[model samples]
Target: MNAPPYLSIVGWARNDGYTPNYAKRLEHSIGFLVRQLDRHRIPSEVIVVEWNPPPGSPLLADQMNGFLGGTSHASVRFIVVPPQFHRGPRGWQKRGMHVNNAANVGFRRARGRFVTPKALDTFYSDKLVSTIGRLDLDDRRVYRCDRLDARMEAESWLDLADDELLAALARHVVLRNGRLTHSIDWKMRDLHTNACGDFILMSTPRWHEIRGYQKDPTVLCLDSDSIALHAAAAHGASEVHWQEECIYKVVHGNTHAQRVATIWKDWQLKLDHYLILRHRRELAMNLRVWLNYPRRRVRGLEEILAPSIERHFVAKAARYAKNDTSLVTNDADWGLARESLSDRTVVRAAWDTP
Candidate 1:
């Protein structure tokens, strides 16, 4: 008998109004993913979904088409989610709606037995593909992995000291490990939850069984991971933390400080709204802890805290805030920094001034 076809990788690119580099970045990401998949000998396809077409944004679509044109992956396809309906709340745009819709469209068109929806901004290593390939798809299971450092180019403004950067990266490793080793496995209730949509692989049948994502057009500030997790759990799915290195670098468009401030502000608003809706006193309290306490304690806190707050609190507040527990409830590990001793690996600065 022929071996079963592997998972179908569905990627959605929602460029609200980005320039040509956005397309370049998307192409680069897709190329990297294709190469990784090829290395693993996994059958995969890339679906490029462009949403909310920007005025005079032909370059992005053209580039995407061009990238797909030369691909050898027989399953790859490109689609455009035409600007059809405005379902989101007034003044609040639904960025994920486009993604959900596009993925849904692709899901219908996909022939693979498994469907894994991944974010466009993520850059994956070969380990990611291998990890996904190794996951068990028979039972209802959710597999998750942690992210590596965000990739900041030499000219990017997010350049930080080697020690500081590694410290920040370590926090993610610690947090992910903490959640897996402690909370989720131990069944300890906590304020923080683990439901990141990125790097999560699930079977396609279960995906559609959950109705995919809610059609709430007004649901702004909500994350796709929380929705997926909740739906999966409600449908009798269990989550397992894959203790493998599936590293992906996040690319930031602003300075570390600016990124932190922006995240904090957004979390403040989201937590406030969550408090009113859920009426949970601990949520409000946890929001404060999430917003302030961790930042005050951790070194090189800017990089990890911003995204952590968004991932653990703001985006998926309902799931995390419902539980009043934390993975790291102490301050001892907060200030610890681990530095690499090897000088052979060159650590370049963010900017190379001529």
Candidate 2:
């Protein structure tokens, strides 16, 4: 019933071995959030839609449960829902769409004009925070930024001072130099763009208009970064003239100087392969057309793929209509039913992790 915030930063996390320095990284992220609260300027809030916090791991809920418990200025606000077992599309368990599913949970609670769905294992700068909270950014365009990746060791990160984090954020690690870059590097990859989870700053209504994240039982898609690209494309969106300001990212794994190469290499290759390669020219053409000058509405991927999916459904219907009695027909019928409704329980983002 209170006033809305300027921005609502949404993300998720789980305490598994897969994430390195999660406590520290998340602690830094929370600290960054606290420092960026500009009441007269950029009033903001943090929404953490946590799904599977492992035992012994720190919950943002417990950290910021004091005065501003349900508000944005709190250490964090949560929509701590349990994970549903419906991992079908793009191997649901690994594609991060589940975390995105968690994002939808927090998104429902957002009263801010803008929301940047991201991951918790990363830390960012105050500049990046302000940039994301822009109250006047065009709703017609999806925003993205390049992130600088780094790593650290485990310690009581919650105690670190902001000065140390500021110094660390200024540092960068690129594969070309094998050390921190002498200058900043944050640009969209040429004509073919690949926005990451942290890169996007979408308007709340735009997020809703796009209908959250895309899903299919068989597709490798929807990380926080690429969702905007695909959604914009599906809606006949603007070309990718993304911001060029560098954003810092904590890698959250091994601090082994030697492992730095492999760690950053894997990440770079991930961006290159997924955002650049894969569909090659087809995706490039699609993105280029959408991203082109004087951008106007055009046929989006939804238009192209909807019929394909419908054709599939129609074909299956014909089979069933033809008295086909097989697992394929039964499974198709079941899949259609499942997609129409929400399975997991829904709750307000202001709720605690119960």
Candidate 3:
């Protein structure tokens, strides 16, 4: 009998207008993985789910051809999905443009015993492959990410060479032993201040038990990560492993990590700032899911009605977006920082184990 694949790494991305940059970073990310997996003869699989092309943007396949060609220890696959699957109210899709639904789609197709779901902006360290290979698999423990910090934001990732990017990260990224770092912002310019990455790793069985990631429309990027973390904790996971710095993240203008409100450069930019209200809804949605998950699981009464609740805030966000339009052109409000919520509350791990 054939041995099963050891690990599966899954991520999805779509860049309708900026496919080249996304494509380059993707190639770099995968190639980095291949370098480690191939030499060690690790049986691994990489699945990229590409979806939703803007009006004239080429299909993700056309933009990413030939990048997957390799005869090695790991197999690479590309999947094209319809955008309708990701569409949400107020034209909101998954938090990261593609979130739980996209990753879950890849999970359903994965063939490895161990699996990792990562953000598209994530770049794995060479040691990560071997780390996963050596991890003592515990059904109750899920692995979380360690980030190396550097706020090396580029207008286009293609602007810097791989070597240059590596040099920049080496100058920063904090790595420590037997310590867990939570939510380190890699986009920070201070090398020592920010050094970390966020990624999730676990056994396929544990993932299946948790029913994969929550696709609640209100869960934003941060909430999505939290939901998975809490789900693991709530499901009787003894503890989670936190690895040393081995993942690098890049902050591009378009990625979720870099989407704070800013001034419009000109009239065209003001008109194109259409995603303002849409993005703000992420704040509302995240709060709803975080607060309600426990109530729904514990009380079983009314089930934390989300649709009507989401509609209630949708109107508020719409008005906020309209208010933002005035600032887009005016100098006064253009630079005002966007505060997602005033009293940011914590979303804890609350899943009850049977």
Candidate 4:
């Protein structure tokens, strides 16, 4: 009998071209990942969640036939999340993608001992893959690594050998860990919370213990990943930052932050910045009294005063300054464990039965 997989890699995406050449990037990311795992002989499973797939577009799973060739060490599966679960409970209603909810769909179904939520366009370094392949990961620790942003045009190197691509892209390191390279006046260089959603690894059990990223769609698309890190720490999971291993993020034009930056003008940025400065002060006091604001009002404020403020201040404060010991955010039904969803085995390992 085949033993359970050593690790489960989970990521969520739609077929819509959200970023430039997104399909190509997704192909490289998953294909390279599968090849690397096979190179190291690691028994693993890759789960890609096709969350709220568009009406007239091809599903991501339909495009995986080309990615799974010559794959032996890892099995790949794709879960389809229907549109009903997209907006989430309490009528949150704002939707492009609910990262946490989509992730939960994969997390609840993962069959591996260890699980990590990754970005669709991310690539795992050889060093990182080798480390995980050893299966020496600790269930009591939450593993994190810094993200290196590469140039958008680096897609030309997609077919290059892994080491060649890695070496070629090393020069494009715009951000190392939390430090923004080639920046003269960016003061937000030291915060490790930057791009954290790209890679977060923890044991499957530990993920369940914390209930998989506060499924609150109300928070919108801001620092929920960082909050999950805090939740992990709160539940006594020690953080293990990988010093030598990091994930590579292919930078594109239409990311959430980049879009926000382009939309907000110089004056708007100044106004939002000032408002965030004040919001942080109020947040500190609110944390004391356990002050709570209506979700409607908060979302309205987010619309007016730059949602980036939630990422920078509100989440940072809740993660570091909060004194509560809440473990999981969703109810007992976290990850929609009870839902009957479509699960397709896109690529099975050679040892597995047809």
Alpha carbon lDDT at 97, candidate 2: 30
Q: List candidate 3 segments past 4 Å from native.
A: 18-20, 93-96, 153-167, 172-197, 218-222, 255-354
Candidate 1 vs candidate 2, lDDT winner: 1
TM-score of 1: 0.59
Name the top lDDT candidate. 4
Superposition error at 77 for model 4 (Å): 0.4
For each candidate, give its TM-score against the true structure. Answer: 0.59, 0.57, 0.61, 0.80
Off by over 4 Å in 2: 53-60, 63-75, 85-97, 132-134, 151-159, 175-192, 216-224, 233-244, 252-354
Question: What are the per-residue Cα lDDT tens digits for candidate 2 across 97-192?
Answer: 355456555665666777777665555565665655455677676666666665434354445676576565465344211112211112121222
Top of the candidates by TM-score? 4
- lDDT of each prediction vs. the true structure? 0.47, 0.47, 0.50, 0.71
Error at 92, model 2, angstroms: 6.7
Over 1-354, each residue of candidate 4 has an lDDT whose tens digit, in order, gives: 267888889999988787777887788888888889899988888999898888898888897765668678788888998877775443344444677788888988998889888897888888989899887989898888888887746557777877877786677777676622422222222334566787778888878877887756453545567776767666667777788888987777655565443233555456546755876644433432242221222323246332344443344435443435543466778777999989888888865455
Which tens-of-lDDT digit does each residue in 12-131 have in candidate 1?
665543323555556666656665665565656665555545556562455554443332332445655555532443323423234445555555444456776677656555556766
Q: What's the lDDT of the predicted structure labeled candidate 1?
A: 0.47
lDDT of 4: 0.71
Stretch of 10 with least lDDT, candidate 4: 182-191
| Candidate 3: residue 84 lDDT (0-100) | 59
